[model samples]
Target: MSLGSSKELAENKIILLYMIDKVNMPVSNHHITKLVLENKFMNYFILQQFLNELCDSGFLELSENGGKSFYSITPNGKKTLEYFVNLIPFGIKSIIDNTIPEIRSDIKKESLISADYTPKSENEYIVSCKLKEDNFTLIDLCITVGTKSDARTICENWKNNPQQIYSEIIASLTRKRDKTNRDKDKDED
Candidate 1:
């Protein structure tokens, strides 16, 4: 559908807010930028301008966490967007609805567990891992290893069983603490 410059920008902003509102979790900037690109919402320059305006106007909540930008619709944004969502073309709305599930699953998987590696020297690397929920990372760990293969192994293992590794670590530490306390008590007695 065709729209005037003013109407186009407004509808695009509404579309953004609508996407944020409909999604159960915050939408990352990458995801939003991709959407804008795939659907030809506007040029990157205009998209950025609208994004900033929305944030400055309190229509969008922009947060940075885990080195990523995530956007959510503020209450005012939702309230304002409610009035304008219908203004978006039905085709766009349908596309948004169709696209959300894939986006949601991808975000969910990535946010739950993540791993990365950086080379510190010719033979050493640092592997970073994170376990996250709702913008909060329950676990963030970095380990230095001897080789890229070692780092890759750790990253892969962490991504596969982060929760299990976390639980085991906590449990082992607690058990050791409890045993130490018991030994101290016995010696005193």
Candidate 2:
């Protein structure tokens, strides 16, 4: 590649790192693809390559979350970003600064409640639901269904009402136990 393309590549790499670094979340490949395309930063192919290259080179870390590839900046990536962030265009930096908050909110929402399905066989599917707050995981549930549609519906329900579901489960589990403990404590008092 020519000098211009090379520089653009480095800048684009930094853009990916900067975005991931800014959000400080396990950003999905889809989100990265969308951001790069929407910002006119680069093409999808280059974005994909950058993700792989960055992770491979220890500039980023990759993990599977919610059955999708999630990328986060490694410590090395942060240092690199800190060092060469000036090379990224001010327009690009401005756009990233403006866009990251929305991404942060979206990722936070995603982390709060999540669902995914895996096929067990020809007819059975298992849907896993997760409800989390900050660093604490409130619930992690798996339901098995005979059909894919059933699994999908369960996932939707879990995503829609994880908080309520968690509350109900907690209430049910505590109801009898709490009542018994309260009766014993009243007698003692």
Candidate 3:
């Protein structure tokens, strides 16, 4: 499909809207681009242009968090999609449907675990790691390290092993003191 044709352009826009609406959540641009490109639906530049145009025309809303752009369908976008979804080819729609579950899983995982680091001084840095669900933060851990490399390593480790780390931390914090050791200490005293 060539971009010069208005019909093809409109269909592409509808395709974008349909994907976002069906996904039923705020989807990051990176996720959308990956889906579209992996399916050979469009090239990177064209996909980006369509996204910007959609936002400009009130068809989609853009929100940014943690340096990632998330797109969600606006009411107008949903209405327009409802009217024009037929323009999108059945094969394309099928592909999108097949991929939605994986996309949802990825988005959920991405949103749940987050880590970042900022420099506090020439030799000091603070790393923040979080586990969140919806708007609730289950854990927000901050650690200060003496070097940028250490901060970066901590952030990377947190992202890669958040569940294990969270479990370990919880276990350590909640573990009961050894009763035998306490009794022995009392006896010694």
Candidate 4:
């Protein structure tokens, strides 16, 4: 959703700043949407609008190659994030305190799975397992892996048979161990 006006856009920047501070990394629009939804603070439209504003204001960078857009915090964005980190504690303390009860209730209803677990649904599982360090999700992971193929393979296996996916992931990592050892040996030589 597009942000309504300059004023609303400013509010979104504040929220995005808070999000960066909370997550400590570049966040994509998808991650921001999840946080907003999870916290019951705003809708997806507003979140997207806010992100666009931040991008326009030189506070964030958006990459376009992947299915998910990646947003990295700029130096200016970092400054804004820092300012909000300090400001929010006191400015919104009362509101935050009041919201805790509801937040807790929502948290109880939302299912959180670990990175290691296979997801029941393809979309839900990918959304859940994607790395959240800064604002990136599984879609970002797919982009970084250089193709949707790897992500699709993993997702397909995960959905069709979780056990098989787990075994494959384990085997893939085990193969990487030997490669790592070889790289280390070359370095030593």
What is candidate 2's lDDT per residue for 1-189, written digit by digit as tens?
Answer: 333577788988998899899888889987888888998888777788888999999999999974678898999999999998998899998999899899888878887888999999989998888888998988898888899999988888888888888899889888766688889999999
lDDT of each: 0.85, 0.87, 0.92, 0.54
Specify the highest-TM-score model's number: 3
**Tens digits of per-residue lDDT for model 3, 147-172:** 99998888889889988989999998
Query: Which scores higher on lDDT, 2 or 3?
Result: 3
In candidate 4, what are the lDDT values of residues 1-189, reduced to their tens digit? 444676555665676666544444444565556656866666777677677877898888887533446667788888877665554445444444454454444332221212232344544433223322224322222222323455566544444454454556668877745688889999999
lDDT of 1 by residue, 146-181 (tens): 999999999988888888998987788777456888
Task: Work out the TM-score per prediction.
Answer: 0.70, 0.72, 0.87, 0.46
RMSD of 4: 12.8
Ranking by lDDT: 3, 2, 1, 4
lDDT of 3 at 56: 100
Clashes of each: 0, 0, 0, 4
